[model samples]
Target chain A: MSTRSLYVSADTPVHRLTARSKIGLATALSIAAFVFTTPIAVGIVLAVAFGALAWAGGLRNLRRVWFIVVALFVVGFVVWPAFTPARGPTVLATPLGSLSSYELRFALGRSFRIVSFIIIGLAFVSATSNEGIVRGLRSIGLPYAFCFAVGTALRLFPTFLSAADTVRQAQEARGLDLSAGNPIERVRGYVPLLVPVFVNAVRQVNDQSMALEARGFDTRGERTFHGKRPLAGRDWIALALATLIVVGTLVGRYGFGVGAL
Target chain B: MREVFTMWRDTRMILLVAVVAAVYAAILLPFKVFTILPGLTSVRPANAFPVVFGLMFGPAAAWGSAIGNLIADIFGGTFGPGSLGGFVGNFFFGFVGYKLWGNLGPLSSGEEPNMRSIRQVVEYVLIAVASSAMCAVIIAWVADLLGLVPFSVLAPIIMVNNTLAAAVLGPPLLYLTYPRIKDIGFLYPELLADEELSAAGASRRYVAAYGLLVVSLVWLGVGLLVGTGAAPGTLTVGLVGLVGFVLVLAFAIIGAERLSAILERAGARPAGRNR
Candidate 1:
């Protein structure tokens, strides 16, 4: 099975940064966007995210989500402010009554916030591998078990995708017309397909468990790993910058009321 | 808690979690419902994973659901900050289901569901409803606070979608797999009950589940009435409903226990088997 997910590897500074620092920076920037919803705050986050995207060579992957982002952006620009009650002093052209400049700005800010989030996410996933995710999460003080579970899930995703495809093909061969129904009917058509797939997956759980145990998976207490990359000064700098973004957003919003939209 | 942590770390359990997450994400990613809102919420039979996997693998399933939702977000083209919310909320989606069933009635010993008892069936539905509400409340609260969507719009949709999947489809699936997994000696939560439940804790969980059911029903009513223009004040009603929902979930999750003893004492069942 192909190990194809959202991940794309490129040789760049952001990509060279450990997964832990990338995750930290992206997560903090995303959270800061949420915490401070003003245009200035969101713009700052968006700029950083775009910088990361450029550095990580994630811009190429933007094609995959362009349609979705554009659709959401249009909706946010047009519909959200029309529905939102809050308004500013200046009035933008309201084809319908009572749309204001503030609502438009706010809506624009929101769209930017979402776009920045998506960019940061794409950058992180593009730079990091399944192993990187497990190690990074473990480094950040998550339980080792949780980290393993995350890594395992990433690794198994392609296998399950293939299995689902095989099940769909088999059902199609059996004359299950999953393609020829109305929307609701089409969804209902999936019931038969899903039931068999799920049952098969459930059945394999026991054997899989047995296999793991036989391979010394049950061995506990003080385990050693092969690829343990300790954090370097560069990683610490990234962490500090991420932490500063979060802390600065909070203090600015509450202390000085600088960026509270 | 220590024993449960060990279960998650066990290699076999980790594999089980991985497979569960992967399958669920794969099934849901392609068919996602792209809303005007910018996150991954889909018309999912994949919702079945948390219910089934939770029963089969315990805490491992909770971790799986969390990671699976993240993976689904990435695949569905909506991975973002909201996914942090998605991860936590989806974890409870499985955790609540597992915790609710693991110690309830005949399942207290972690035996396979025989489907012989009406009370157990009702309990499953109650658990489904409460868990759905729990997920909807937590996620919508964060989303609304961050100005994604109003609580009224997001909560009802999620609550209805999840409950319909779990209630309509979960039991038959659970029944079908129970015997097979038991035969294979992989029916999880096999450990005898370790936590000593005080009566108060048990009653609180019962009350909480029941309260959540009623409050959610009323919240749904308010949503319907408002949608049809029969009622005004949606935001007010929605905010109120959200508060009530969160309070009840606290009771359900934090003070959790089996409701079998209470139901039997209330004369719902004439005979209590194997007490």
Candidate 2:
């Protein structure tokens, strides 16, 4: 399995930003990407997202998500025209019957929107660690219980992956060729692999519950956490800029309908 | 609300949630990476999670499924603002599955399913189908509103994917795991509710099923009207209408049976006492 984190721990401006600010900015940019439906507006957002990724020294992470983006582009290319309710004058192609220029434009705009969303999202993940996410969520008024639960969940992800790997290996040793069979047979083959993992996982749960009880982990009160980075002025400025981009696009799209197809 | 908080307060329960979430994400991320439409949708074996986890872990499983989806999104490189919709929608998958399963019939005391009993098996299937439909409706509706994808395209795909995964993998796992965990002394969510609350819960599920029955019937009616009134080439609309009609009838019939079963059990008990 691939790793859970793509964080680079760089010292660039984007990495130095507080996790809360980065998360907020990612959310704002993603909303803007979804709201706007024009090529130019989405193209600009994509440019800004790429710029941030470069600043964070996390452009390397783009390699991981390229296939997904290409898939999105391809699927949208086919589906948008076939299902689009509108008919246009300009015919773009006759492959699989006639296609319209208008549908192609629609697909391009949608693809740009998707690309911008992924770029900003990956940039945020590349810059922030899991611990940083807990702190960020806690600082933003989320309950400590929620933060702890999510933090523990993030920490344990790799452990489960390792356990699954062990199970798969053991099954392979016993002649389970998951890839060699037809689709239905492969799906059936996964049962032996999964049942053992799930049963072992339940067994592990018993040990976990006991360990937690020994730690007195249920005591409820105000708790203290160390090593949380305070949001500085630059974080605020970054958030403000994100807000402006989002608001500007919303106005352009809805107030004047400038970005409508 | 109190049960939700209580589950959170228990450290062991919290640990269970974490472990379940981690396992779920580990299973989910691989499928998520190679997507039909990366950010919008995918063919997910990950869909099997809510039913299995919910049956095993209860409310914590709901929270775990939601958080796990977010983690999987990040790992799969599909994380975005749209994740908010995913969070809420995925939560319902577990919530509804566990709630409906525990209330509908006796299912071997939360340890293992009594697979020989056809009623229990039907209950499991009903929960899986209903949960998949609920998750699909909420997530796809939000995606449509966000302009992520058209509702017509997204909902059916998600519903089919989730249902297929759960139907294929859910029952045998339930049968296998129940015998091992039944004696573990941990508090299962089915044991959390009193008899009165469970009966009330069953009634509420019936109400939800009836509501879905009405909405789906209306959808079929509208589709038929448009199909007949419009040009002869609109055969697709008519077919879609027929499919909608069939799906809703299945839901209604199963739901009514469950309700009747609950009532019979209640009536068989001593007077003025909760089952």
Candidate 3:
């Protein structure tokens, strides 16, 4: 019955910020990460992202994605240098060509930029609940139906996953050999697993639609929500700080060339 | 495309959207550990869901697949700025197949969607390839623009991954479920028949849209090759790719709007049952 999500329950300020504000802050940090081209600037953003995740007690979840993070870092570091033009003094020689200091530095900056993106993404999801995501998006003027669908999907994700597992087990019990086939046949083995789940889903849709109509789901009017709260003063402060960081980074990069490679 | 927006008004369509999303994410989540490219994409048998569901559920599948992909990314630990591309890319992965099936194939004269006939099967494969390419170009272009992954590398990989899954799993799934869904009164065309009434008269426009889609895809493919193949940082190459990207968006939006006009006209007709 357990659902998969990245949200970590905590009482820290990072988690306490309204979902909308957190979304805004995460967006701002992401934009700044892309704008800054220097290793130093990108490193600062990465540090801030990591620090924020730690503050929210969401760092524990990093274990799940450590492989991806490490792989991205390694790929960025290696690939960018290979493509980059050799410039400045020679740092190393290879069969292909000599590596320059500038190429090495560019590689370092790109690696940090890529890693920063994942950190910011993890931080945002770790602090915001699925319901909060829907509410926040709704408050920002998305259509109610779309938001409802998104929230419903999040809730149903776990149910369906569990159902797929059950269907697979049942099929196995009935002597379905999923592993004893060519690649294409192995994929075809998914037919039984997929069909039953989809059929059950269609049946649920019919009943669910009836329930929705009975609850006046199609009615037009202002609707009230549970757990709705006004944006607090602390939310404003968080938003302002995020704005400042983004604006400052852009100004430093474009106006003064402080973060350029 | 018009139904993509109008379906929001129907409670059942909204519910279908949720169901599709849940099913897609459920199928996609287990494969998260098998990363073909970390933080970009993974080995995806679930890629077939979008095509089969799109053919069955229409616009609901488009929106649902988009949301489902986003959910997979969030839980799979791959959510990032590139997720914007993934959302749009997955939307079209579902959208293009449904939109093109009856408009461009042997079924273009308004035959019901099926996989029994050889011509119908060929048409299904073409639809799968076109949709897969559309998804790959959009995602790889965005990833390249963000400097995350090169188009030359990611585009071909995604195209093959998606097309293979769709070609392998799509027809059988459709054959199994299409008749049952139609019987249950949940088949998208029947369920939304009122809104899609003008579909008969709009075939030419649909063909035109498909043409523009093909042109844009070609433009993007050529531009990406030229941009990345020559001097890596050439200004003209960048401009070529940028222009190509803009044309793809422009043509896609224009085509959707044209189809939406058809729906608007259909809605203006007298409220009566034709079925």
Candidate 4:
């Protein structure tokens, strides 16, 4: 578990921006990343995105997602070419095989496209807390209750795994050997292991609801903030840069097309 | 503010469990176990995850499982309205278990499950297995009838697949609820502390000591009945799953009905007391 999911964070300028803005930035960049078939454009965009992420989330955290990045890249650049093979003009050659210009382009385009998606996703998850996200929604005049549920779901994700781990440990100590045996025997092992995890989960929620009810969670009153979460000057700069890059690239791709480029 | 933060953190732990289930359901099943099951082809953890979600988080959990499965299908390129049917079917699969616990009010006359009565244990297993089996079969059958999924490709697989999921995952999920429910706050107090682990729960522990006996009896029985293609074997496995589902439901119902009776006679009895 690299634990570098979209949820990890640092209170940098990028982190302080609105979650919706971050989401929009990623979505827009991903669309542009999809447009440019030239590896040169993708290479530039990836470099810029990587720099932004390193500044926002720390290079170390970005490095943690290398396996995921590599895996997806492999799926895009290698696995897909193998499956579909090249059908268009010749572009890249290898001793083992050669890629048609179109196949090579598709794979290269996809790799960069998805890379942008992942980087932006990582940025948003890293920067935003579910509370701030929910409050941000409320600030936009969205219903608070629905935002609360979504926020709660986001917050509880990690805790659920810990409980599941606890159940796995309990079964393992009892010599249940969940990891052993053939595939069928192994899957069968989960019944005993996961059942308990589910049990604990249900029980935990009931307790949580009771605790929340005690604390007047549902009372119709103005909510208060506990921690400092603020928008800073640098956050706006990152947003502006992301916007410029996205708009410029899209305009370049659409207006010029490949021949003009 | 600190108290509110701490409480939110605590609740996050519970949601984390759902996330774990979602991730495990997505990642683990695809790689080896789901893929390499020799006789079985394309047995998805996606459908059963909804069941597991229902068991864990009441009805609300099913929504996440459903959405998660839908998302996984989209990425995996297996999405269709047919799968959407499967999602709904899977929701009912969990509803079977949650329905048991939520049969009465939220809580009142919950009864503890004990294996002292073998007959009751048998009955419990049957209902749990049967409930989900019935749900799976009906959904597949209706979908086929309604032309949601083709009968040629999906109908048989759906029944066997759903039943396999229910039979395999449902029982243990139902059974494991006993020990953890107290800490989870599903019960009014510690239900399992006074009561010994049920025959099903303790069955794994005793397997070593009674290794031969269990192997000869249970495994041999599995071989004979399943090998011989007896309906009874299928029925037995199916029902056994419900054993826990039935027990949990029994407790939930009993607790709901008997809340006043029990609460009226509460901690007045003092500590170190058995219910």
Candidate 5:
């Protein structure tokens, strides 16, 4: 059930970097992406990142998680205008109708910014396991409770997704037409599904807590994690390169004006 | 001795609650087909489950429901202005439910909520109304505090809409769903009685659910009373802020037994049976 097209390309240099460095590199890229809202700058960074993904895995990873990026982009570009009081930079002109140039351009740039981060997130998931991230967080002195919650959430995502599927199917077998109903009818249809899903979630949490206790989860005031992935030299170098890419963009934005990007 | 409440011997109940929680997450998710609320809308019905769970299970259930809400938000596409607003709003939403149900009882497995009594129903209404008012006030204050949006913009509409939505939606949802809660594993009567021998290491989440409800409600009351900077919300004034939380505590405790009946159907609770 945990199986899927892995976001992390196998045996790649970026994939091999210590998760700590990767997270740092990813954060730097995100900062650069956020700052350089200029279309040209965003386009170039997106292209470079996409190229890296192609080289590491294939066009496949990009295709698989592209939906998330697109969703974020649309929300920032389209939904924000309607909801927020402040209007975005205008960018277009329509002689006959209501569309304008300024608002359009600003939306496009915002879209680019969000999509760029999604790619960064993809880099995170594709390169490291959830355990790696958890250990990295704990080692870096994040609260045990917080880190544990994250780890459990990630670890259980696949399981929960699968459990959901199982229950959905079981309900369907009992005359539940999951796909064909009005929104209200469908919500009511979900009654059968909710019972089992929550029962399982509660059961799992209880099980997980017990499992942790048995493994001495709360035995000592401090806890140590194993399976620490070491930072190979190649991994560090890739990380440095990633950092430089972002730093260059930021420096260009604030120091040299938008043109530097 | 109290820790023994966690065992799950009844396979069906455990299976049911887990499945219910998962499905509950799916349904509340904004992208989920059944989303009744529109894009960026805060009112949601699926909240009753976690509220019930927290009241039944304790603080963890509160956290779980909160997480579930966040999950739904992210999957629906991370709404930028939404991140903090949604988190706090939903947190209090579930928190109020937990506070109502969790602490009012002695917060132990054997102790029941007197569900058969209409007094419990009154308690539920009081808890629901008080919690709703508190939530509405905090959401408005916090929204202003963050400067993400202005009170001038949001308060006029939200103040009225939220109060009505919470009071109306919260009680019916609880009433309809509360009856089914006993079906969950840890609360199974058969297993609790037969497996009392394994009670030593059992988890007290079930008990804590009730106890923590009382404690958390007090926190909510204190927050509401102080944050409003006035008195109980009315017409245009909305929630008025108070200085000390004494009134808030009084509201929670005085209404404590009258509201937040976590121990309903005490004999029906399946405390030590959780495997």
Candidate 6:
């Protein structure tokens, strides 16, 4: 029932950058993770991502979700190699198959890549608010209506979650045993819970739409914002750095064959 | 295709998008504990929301599902590179059901969107499965391309998860809500201008689109089996599958655009709101 978002309020250089720049940096780091297939290259990207997270003061956020990070890392490091075909020198013989050093390196690199993505995503979300996301996307030239919908959706998430919990409680009070069923039965049990929630939502749409239209929601022409801030010099520097990282990784991976597993 | 963008113009449709996004994400958040693959996917009973909402609200649900899944990932601690794929995949997960529901056999003769009859139920299940498979392919393919996961491993998992949720929960929810929503004059077709709902070239163009979809899915399915069975960890097969997927998806997009253009040319008039 916690309504808090991942954004941690702080005054840091990473937090000072605009959401658009953070988004760009995250994208660049993600692409770098995907492009680089060598353990060393992936490790470097992971390091940079972690460094960004630390700079954003969001390292605690990473600690909060450490279980998932560790689980994914384990899956990638231990389980993924089993799916990969053994190649190069054989490291060990097991009942399933012979383990290869090449597969181990591939697994390690993949794990690092996934971890780097997580860190970059954490850094971005930790520094960006829901309004910031909408504003940043608008600044990046997405249509106003789409951005408005996204912002509204984010704002409504907590409200809907609270409503759903209330409904679940009311249903349970009415003898709806949600936990005492098999998987299919449990899924079917959701019908009672979902029907009322959805019906109520549908009913609200009329009122909500009327209210929106009353506020000149359908008005056309250029709109002005109350607190719009143009991207500063630091924003451009962040953008340039993100572009450099992506282009550098791309060139290193394909152009020079530097990161091939 | 036009409705996808045009829905943003209608206040009701835009509100529906927000409601769907909020509802879907809210339901999805609690289910994060049932993780089948950490940071990738889970046993998502919330998957049913997209199909049901899609059938009721049309293209708004498509956008909603995409945004909703992204929201879930962002809050649920699973957001990552693969989430880009999840966004697009969940859009089709909601989209294909509504698109095919009214266009496919038995239901293609301009039937109202309902789950009243056995034949209609069959069609619904078929659409759910199709949407589920399409969603799976898009996500698994992207994951494979990104080297995050193998296609052969992830596709079936997502397919089963989505189809099971949609098939189990879709009918009763749709049966209960469709009539009420329609009565309230909130059905997508009721809210939009008739030009937005124009059916010109729909049947033929959809046939082409669905035909290509089936073929591409089959191609990907075979590639999945080969990639997993014959040669695990091979890039060539995955690349070939990607090419076929992209080619077929491009044709499907073209077919949809042609349908939209034809509808625009036919100059369908608005069916004024009954309310």
Docking class of 4: incorrect
Sorted on DockQ, best first, the list reads 3, 6, 2, 1, 5, 4
4 or 5, greater by TM-score: 5
How far off is model 2, as Cα RMSD?
Answer: 6.0
Q: How well does candidate 6 match the true structure in TM-score terms? A: 0.90
Model 2, A116-175: lDDT tens digits are 877888898888888887888888898888888899889888788788778889989999
By DockQ, is 2 or 4 better? 2
Model 3 chain A poorest ten-residue lDDT run: A1-10
Residue A150 in candidate 5 has what lDDT? 50
Candidate 5 backbone overlaps, count: 69
Tens-place lDDT digits, model 5, residues A195-258: 5665556556556656656665642266665666676787678668777867787678877897
Candidate chain B TM-scores, in order: 0.69, 0.68, 0.81, 0.47, 0.52, 0.83
**Considering only chain B, what TM-score does candidate 6 achieve?**
0.83
Q: Which residues of candidate 3, in runs, are more than 4 Å off? A: A1-3, A177-182, B32-40, B105-110, B196-203, B231-275
Provide DockQ values for all models, in the order shown: 0.42, 0.47, 0.58, 0.08, 0.10, 0.57
lDDT of 1 at B74: 72
Error of 6 at B109 (Å): 8.0
Off by over 4 Å in 2: A83-88, A95-97, B31-45, B102-114, B190-205, B208-275
lDDT of 2 by residue, B1-275 (tens): 23445566666667777877888887776543124445446555557778877766667778888888888877777777667768877886776664555344343122234344666677677778777876766665565556555456666777777777777667776776655655563425332333322233456555545444344434533443443344355445435544653554355333321222332353522333332
Model 5 ranges off by over 4 Å: A1-6, A56-58, A65-68, A71-75, A79-101, A179-182, A204-208, A238-250, A259-261, B1-31, B34-54, B65-93, B99-275
Pairs of colliding residues, candidate 6: none
lDDT of each: 0.65, 0.67, 0.77, 0.46, 0.48, 0.76
Q: What lDDT does candidate 2 reach at residue A128?
A: 86
Poorest 10 consecutive residues by lDDT, candidate 5 chain B:
B1-10
Worst 10 residues of 4 chain A by lDDT: A1-10
User: What TM-score would every model get versus the actual structure?
Assistant: 0.81, 0.83, 0.90, 0.54, 0.61, 0.90
